[model samples]
Target: MSKVSLPRHVHRVVSRGREYFYYQERRGTLHAGERIRLPNDPQTPEFWNAVRQAQGTFGPTPTDTIGALIDAFEVSWATRQRKISKGTQEHYRRYLKPARKAWGDLPARELRPRHVDALIRKIGADKPGAANNILDALKAMVSWANGPVELLTHDPTQGVERFSKGEGHRPWTSQQLAFAEQVFTGTIRRFFFLSRYTGQRISDVVRLSPNDVDDGGFSLPQKKTGVKPWCPIFPELEAEMVTWERRPGPYLLQSSGKSAGKPFSTNQMWKAFDRERKKYSVLSGAVPHGLRANAVIRLRGEGYTALQISDMVGMSVEMVESYSRHADRKASGQAVLREFQERDASQIVKRLESGKRK
Candidate 1:
């Protein structure tokens, strides 16, 4: 078994042969007491985003104190208007709790990069990843307080050194896709298909509603990017989606058992998805979110441009290119072969003419 490094304040426990991870402060619970279960096995991009988004470093000495500024920022448009996800808000609260105890009474205007640097070192000693996460939250807070009536004139987190966060999750392979599709059944199989075709994270995928479907396409904002793009339902996917019998609820994916037919929370959704995923003898690094990579690669192979892929998947061109490199390599090789074939045909004809002349 490989060693796993969790974020600051996060602990892991294995119960009944399953692993669960979460953040806990000495006093208060993180995320308003909502348990955030970190992804198991191969940590994907979505899992890293959830980890980096949740850790942060608090409350009220004065209106101009750092704590006060964080309070104000939390209620600002970014949080209130859903610019960030629910997991992000919980992270803000979790980190701020400790911050309040440390510097809640300090004036925000007096803060300097050196002060933030010291705090980062203290946290990084335990978990460098969470140190960066906390730094990100402070940076956001200070930026939010840049108005005429704001608390600070300069952002203290500007020059703070960020600990290195490694390259995130790996992409899924064609073999892994085939194995998963073969093993997964019923709702799990539907989820596998939906994610592959739609290029959506499981978080957003679980919340999909029957009403979100239409003649145009599937309409929904991406949870990570906050961009809403219409995805055309291809014949293969449309047939499956159209035939799905949604429970008597708004969510397209519903839970089984005592909570049968109810919508799945973020934790519940991933846990259930993982439960089914673990049963398969698939690739070690395979993850559900890698379906996004599958979609991008498949589309590129079918001659879809990067911009078209971006629009369909609600990702930037850079992201699409990263996942479609395999397809690009194949296309390049095919182009080279075509050129060789054309040149060889002309040379063959010339040789035949020369032989006839002789």
Candidate 2:
């Protein structure tokens, strides 16, 4: 077999918005360009179509330099991740869309620090956490692209700023839970109770089926972490799920139609929760995921060990500490801490009377 001669090294670069570096060999001539304008996303199909039209214009399978490819990677990454949840995906797309418009055609080796900084700054402005998320995903994409062609010697994200945790995890009181119970019905009620109990993410729980309940407990494969989340079910929840299962439906809530169907979208599920929350008139701005934090706070007050809580909730120990600062008390329906403490002031009055007698 004859070996194909390796093509001359086309210059590679990391992508900087509006610019990047590139090296080219044309008819035995070598040249370099930085931050060359390529097609933005709006111009992508046309640009690539032009590439196909100009296929042999450069050479076979002519591709953008490393800098440009990184932008391509971000676009693909953003699109795929968006399918994870409509609203969540939209948040990522908001950044990647403009980013692709800015850096879509540069070579990989041309990417610059400022380009990364600009994108991060943009996302961090309105949504700080999303900024960090996109940054991390881009770092992985660059790492993969760099290794294939050695375009970059160092990772751009090493110095990127991450989002802060903000005061603490969002918490919901037991009274909030009671109101939610009143508001949501049928499978949704079951789903809400389970969220409060297991702290499994709504994204994770909405897909659950009766078969997931097995061997005296339920096992769920967490979407984000890809770990088996097996926990003993509450006797009441288990019974409720059984009754719900006897009725015709593939999901505990809504996703597919009849036995065969598409899964419930994350946005749809959340919208439903909002409708119910409004109907009950309990609290505003309380999201489904906050139930996880509420459960952690509740269990912590009950004096449950963080390790034990983590086991039940299918979260990592670090995540457990990050969520629960304390043990074994329910946060779902408790009165406000300030009010509850004030209600107990009679103890201090009794001690004062004893001192007066002495």
Candidate 3:
């Protein structure tokens, strides 16, 4: 291959007769020692786009600014410590994109609670969920910068508050579940059954395969919490699984389209689920995460304690109780009524015996 002239800051090296390009900042620059690999062919648009992005990201960011702090924090969070999960990192990046654009040039020390409050209000005006997500991302970044990184002296998000997210993802009622059973079939039904029975988040549910199943139950480490729990196969779920045709990859694969044979992404699964859910007015309020609550409620109704349910579902006992609040209340009411009836019957028997003796 002939030598192709590369752009400034872009270097090319030959290894085993193959060429690879990399973007490395010049010495004594604001972002010195920063290196990012570029695409092989400089003639393609992808190569230029990658170069542009690398330059913008690893370029000369102003010192002591929010952008610089965020850039450093992201590098440390992603590369050094790597405590954050990939899914969570992607989630934080979604919110951080807008924040970076809005306050990138702002001095890190100048950030205040008032500024955060204003940003939340503006973002929350239309989308409270988005505002809350952004607030959380900001809080995490600020906390990291304040604590270990020592980029900021004081916390700007100390008094900052997130927008109120109303009662999120209401649990599916028995009637709704029955309706769903009648309406959804095949892949969609499998998705529903896995989510409802396993009580796993959609992220985990979509990735489940037949191999994950054993004599005991589904064995997998949860993506978000990193808890590996053996989710026992319920009778209902077991019956449903018997009907499913086992596939190579994920149990739930994309049936059709260009992505067929590939596992369904979380967003794709949500859209598919929502489409089926919206067809029936009865399931209008039901969401995917609500199935987790349904599992908790079902377990509680089956006489499982919160601790037991927590162990089974890889959730905290507090969270299990939170999800099964209505079930707990009903169980408590039933127990009280039973105790009262037993006491009344015992008193009546004692009175009859006393009357006979008199």
Best by TM-score: 3
Candidate 2 ranges beyond 4 A from true positions: 1-62, 65-98, 148-151, 242-263, 302-308, 326-357
- In angstroms, give how far residue 173 of model 1 lies from its true place: 0.8
lDDT per residue for candidate 1 within 71-131, as digits (tens), equals 5565453423336665566777776665667787687778888888998999999888788
**What residue pairs clash in candidate 3, if any at all?**
none
> lDDT by residue for model 2 over 152-234, one digit each (tens)?
67665567777775645466766887777666676568768777766888777776766677687768777665667666676
**lDDT of all predictions:** 0.70, 0.60, 0.82
lDDT of 3 by residue, 64-150 (tens): 777667665554543444366666777787888877788878988998888888888898999999999988988888887888657
**Better candidate number, 1 or 2, judged by TM-score:** 1
Q: Which structure is stronger by lDDT: 1 or 2?
A: 1
Q: In terms of TM-score, how similar is model 3 to the real structure?
A: 0.76
Q: Spell out the clash pairs found in candidate 1.
A: 56-95, 57-95, 58-96
TM-score of each: 0.66, 0.64, 0.76
Candidate 2 CA-lDDT value: 0.60
Summed over model 3, clashes come to 0
